[model samples]
Target: MTSDDVRHRREAGHFVRWALAQKIARDLSFPAVRWNGPSQAMDDEARWATARRLLHDDTLKSEDR
Candidate 1:
Protein backbone atom coordinates (compact mmCIF):
# COMPACT_ATOMS: atom_id res chain seq x y z
CA MET A 1 0.00 0.00 0.00
CA THR A 2 1.02 3.62 -0.52
CA SER A 3 1.97 6.08 2.21
CA ASP A 4 -1.25 8.00 1.62
CA ASP A 5 -3.29 4.87 2.17
CA VAL A 6 -1.39 4.10 5.35
CA ARG A 7 -2.00 7.59 6.71
CA HIS A 8 -5.69 7.44 5.89
CA ARG A 9 -5.95 4.06 7.56
CA ARG A 10 -4.38 5.41 10.76
CA GLU A 11 -6.63 8.45 10.78
CA ALA A 12 -9.69 6.32 10.28
CA GLY A 13 -8.60 4.06 13.09
CA HIS A 14 -8.30 7.03 15.43
CA PHE A 15 -11.75 8.23 14.50
CA VAL A 16 -13.26 4.80 15.11
CA ARG A 17 -11.63 4.56 18.54
CA TRP A 18 -13.00 7.96 19.52
CA ALA A 19 -16.44 7.35 18.10
CA LEU A 20 -16.73 4.02 19.88
CA ALA A 21 -15.70 5.65 23.13
CA GLN A 22 -18.37 8.31 22.76
CA LYS A 23 -20.92 5.68 21.83
CA ILE A 24 -20.10 3.73 24.96
CA ALA A 25 -20.24 6.83 27.10
CA ARG A 26 -23.70 7.68 25.80
CA ASP A 27 -24.88 4.13 26.26
CA LEU A 28 -23.74 4.26 29.86
CA SER A 29 -25.73 7.34 30.85
CA PHE A 30 -26.87 10.82 30.03
CA PRO A 31 -24.98 13.74 31.47
CA ALA A 32 -26.54 15.21 34.59
CA VAL A 33 -26.03 18.64 36.10
CA ARG A 34 -24.79 18.69 39.64
CA TRP A 35 -26.60 20.70 42.29
CA ASN A 36 -24.21 23.64 41.85
CA GLY A 37 -22.13 22.70 38.87
CA PRO A 38 -22.20 21.89 35.18
CA SER A 39 -23.33 18.65 33.65
CA GLN A 40 -21.10 15.62 34.16
CA ALA A 41 -20.53 12.44 32.21
CA MET A 42 -20.20 8.87 33.41
CA ASP A 43 -17.35 8.36 35.85
CA ASP A 44 -13.95 7.00 34.76
CA GLU A 45 -14.62 3.71 36.49
CA ALA A 46 -17.82 3.35 34.55
CA ARG A 47 -16.08 4.18 31.32
CA TRP A 48 -13.35 1.58 31.89
CA ALA A 49 -15.93 -0.96 32.91
CA THR A 50 -17.69 -0.34 29.65
CA ALA A 51 -14.43 -0.66 27.77
CA ARG A 52 -13.66 -3.93 29.48
CA ARG A 53 -16.93 -5.36 28.23
CA LEU A 54 -15.99 -4.82 24.59
CA LEU A 55 -15.10 -8.07 22.76
CA HIS A 56 -13.66 -6.75 19.55
CA ASP A 57 -12.43 -3.68 17.74
CA ASP A 58 -14.25 -2.20 14.78
CA THR A 59 -12.36 -0.79 11.79
CA LEU A 60 -14.81 1.69 10.39
CA LYS A 61 -14.55 3.77 7.26
CA SER A 62 -14.23 7.53 7.37
CA GLU A 63 -17.82 7.96 6.28
CA ASP A 64 -18.99 5.46 8.86
CA ARG A 65 -17.07 7.33 11.55
Candidate 2:
Protein backbone atom coordinates (compact mmCIF):
# COMPACT_ATOMS: atom_id res chain seq x y z
CA MET A 1 0.00 0.00 0.00
CA THR A 2 1.06 3.59 -0.57
CA SER A 3 2.13 5.85 2.28
CA ASP A 4 -0.98 7.95 1.84
CA ASP A 5 -3.18 4.90 2.12
CA VAL A 6 -1.46 3.81 5.32
CA ARG A 7 -1.76 7.29 6.79
CA HIS A 8 -5.41 7.48 5.95
CA ARG A 9 -6.05 4.12 7.53
CA ARG A 10 -4.22 5.13 10.67
CA GLU A 11 -6.18 8.34 10.94
CA ALA A 12 -9.41 6.48 10.41
CA GLY A 13 -8.53 4.04 13.15
CA HIS A 14 -7.82 6.90 15.52
CA PHE A 15 -11.13 8.53 14.70
CA VAL A 16 -13.09 5.32 15.23
CA ARG A 17 -11.36 4.71 18.54
CA TRP A 18 -12.09 8.26 19.62
CA ALA A 19 -15.72 7.90 18.65
CA LEU A 20 -16.06 4.63 20.56
CA ALA A 21 -14.46 6.19 23.61
CA GLN A 22 -16.78 9.14 23.51
CA LYS A 23 -19.82 6.89 23.30
CA ILE A 24 -18.58 4.81 26.20
CA ALA A 25 -17.94 7.91 28.31
CA ARG A 26 -21.40 9.24 27.64
CA ASP A 27 -22.96 5.87 28.38
CA LEU A 28 -21.13 5.70 31.69
CA SER A 29 -21.62 9.27 32.79
CA PHE A 30 -25.40 9.39 32.97
CA PRO A 31 -28.64 7.76 32.00
CA ALA A 32 -29.92 8.61 28.55
CA VAL A 33 -31.16 12.16 28.64
CA ARG A 34 -34.50 12.94 27.01
CA TRP A 35 -34.38 16.23 25.22
CA ASN A 36 -37.45 17.29 23.21
CA GLY A 37 -38.46 14.11 21.37
CA PRO A 38 -35.18 12.28 20.65
CA SER A 39 -33.30 10.59 23.48
CA GLN A 40 -29.60 10.30 24.15
CA ALA A 41 -29.99 6.53 24.44
CA MET A 42 -30.95 6.22 20.80
CA ASP A 43 -28.04 8.36 19.76
CA ASP A 44 -25.66 6.34 21.88
CA GLU A 45 -26.93 3.09 20.39
CA ALA A 46 -26.44 4.37 16.85
CA ARG A 47 -22.96 5.65 17.63
CA TRP A 48 -21.97 2.38 19.22
CA ALA A 49 -23.26 0.42 16.23
CA THR A 50 -21.47 2.64 13.75
CA ALA A 51 -18.23 2.44 15.66
CA ARG A 52 -18.43 -1.35 15.76
CA ARG A 53 -19.14 -1.54 12.05
CA LEU A 54 -16.24 0.75 11.20
CA LEU A 55 -13.85 -1.21 13.35
CA HIS A 56 -14.86 -4.39 11.57
CA ASP A 57 -14.58 -2.96 8.07
CA ASP A 58 -11.26 -2.92 6.22
CA THR A 59 -11.53 0.67 5.10
CA LEU A 60 -12.48 3.41 7.53
CA LYS A 61 -13.94 6.79 6.69
CA SER A 62 -13.70 9.75 9.04
CA GLU A 63 -15.91 12.79 8.74
CA ASP A 64 -13.24 14.94 10.35
CA ARG A 65 -10.85 14.29 7.51
Candidate 3:
Protein backbone atom coordinates (compact mmCIF):
# COMPACT_ATOMS: atom_id res chain seq x y z
CA MET A 1 0.00 0.00 0.00
CA THR A 2 1.08 3.57 -0.66
CA SER A 3 1.46 6.37 1.83
CA ASP A 4 -1.03 9.22 2.42
CA ASP A 5 0.34 11.10 -0.57
CA VAL A 6 -0.74 8.57 -3.14
CA ARG A 7 -4.18 8.25 -1.62
CA HIS A 8 -4.92 11.96 -1.75
CA ARG A 9 -4.07 12.20 -5.46
CA ARG A 10 -5.67 9.20 -7.13
CA GLU A 11 -8.99 10.46 -8.40
CA ALA A 12 -7.80 12.13 -11.58
CA GLY A 13 -8.02 9.06 -13.75
CA HIS A 14 -8.30 5.30 -14.06
CA PHE A 15 -4.64 4.57 -13.48
CA VAL A 16 -4.71 6.00 -10.01
CA ARG A 17 -7.88 4.15 -9.25
CA TRP A 18 -6.31 0.97 -10.58
CA ALA A 19 -3.26 1.51 -8.42
CA LEU A 20 -5.36 2.20 -5.34
CA ALA A 21 -7.55 -0.77 -6.11
CA GLN A 22 -4.48 -2.95 -6.28
CA LYS A 23 -3.35 -1.66 -2.92
CA ILE A 24 -6.79 -2.31 -1.44
CA ALA A 25 -6.82 -5.85 -2.77
CA ARG A 26 -3.59 -6.54 -0.94
CA ASP A 27 -5.08 -6.22 2.55
CA LEU A 28 -8.77 -5.54 2.93
CA SER A 29 -8.78 -6.29 6.66
CA PHE A 30 -6.56 -3.34 7.44
CA PRO A 31 -7.87 0.21 7.75
CA ALA A 32 -8.13 1.36 4.16
CA VAL A 33 -6.96 4.85 3.25
CA ARG A 34 -8.38 5.44 -0.17
CA TRP A 35 -6.88 7.78 -2.76
CA ASN A 36 -9.16 10.62 -3.81
CA GLY A 37 -7.61 13.12 -6.22
CA PRO A 38 -5.74 13.59 -9.47
CA SER A 39 -2.93 11.23 -10.30
CA GLN A 40 0.58 12.64 -10.56
CA ALA A 41 2.08 13.03 -14.00
CA MET A 42 5.04 10.73 -13.78
CA ASP A 43 7.13 8.79 -16.23
CA ASP A 44 6.09 5.15 -16.09
CA GLU A 45 9.52 4.03 -17.23
CA ALA A 46 11.20 5.85 -14.38
CA ARG A 47 8.79 4.39 -11.86
CA TRP A 48 9.43 0.90 -13.18
CA ALA A 49 13.14 1.54 -12.99
CA THR A 50 12.86 2.50 -9.37
CA ALA A 51 10.78 -0.54 -8.59
CA ARG A 52 13.33 -2.75 -10.32
CA ARG A 53 16.12 -1.20 -8.33
CA LEU A 54 14.29 -1.76 -5.07
CA LEU A 55 13.53 -5.37 -5.98
CA HIS A 56 17.14 -6.00 -6.91
CA ASP A 57 18.38 -4.40 -3.73
CA ASP A 58 16.11 -6.57 -1.63
CA THR A 59 17.12 -9.65 -3.55
CA LEU A 60 20.79 -8.97 -3.07
CA LYS A 61 20.31 -8.27 0.61
CA SER A 62 18.47 -11.55 1.06
CA GLU A 63 21.27 -13.39 -0.73
CA ASP A 64 23.71 -12.11 1.91
CA ARG A 65 22.29 -14.71 4.32
Assess each prediction's global lDDT (C-alpha) against the native.
Answer: 0.53, 0.55, 0.57
Worst 10 residues of 1 by lDDT: 25-34
User: Tens digits of per-residue lDDT for model 2 on 1-65?
Assistant: 23544545545555556766878434322223234854545677887887787777656566521
Candidate that would win on lDDT: 3
Give candidate 1's error at residue 45 in angstroms. 37
Look at candidate 2 and give me any clashing residue pairs: none
Writing each residue's lDDT as its tens digit, candidate 3 over 1-65 gives: 34555653334445545656888444323344466754886599977886787777755665552
Model 1 per-residue lDDT at 38: 39
lDDT of 1 by residue, 1-65 (tens): 22544545545555556766878434332223236643678798977865655533355443443
Pairs that collide, model 1: none
- Give the RMSD in angstroms, all C-alphas superposed, for model 3: 12.5
Q: Mark the 10 consecutive residues where model 3 has the least summed lDDT.
A: 24-33
- Order the candidates by lDDT, highest first: 3, 2, 1
Worst 10 residues of 2 by lDDT: 25-34
Off by over 4 Å in 2: 1-7, 24-65
Clashes of each: 0, 0, 2
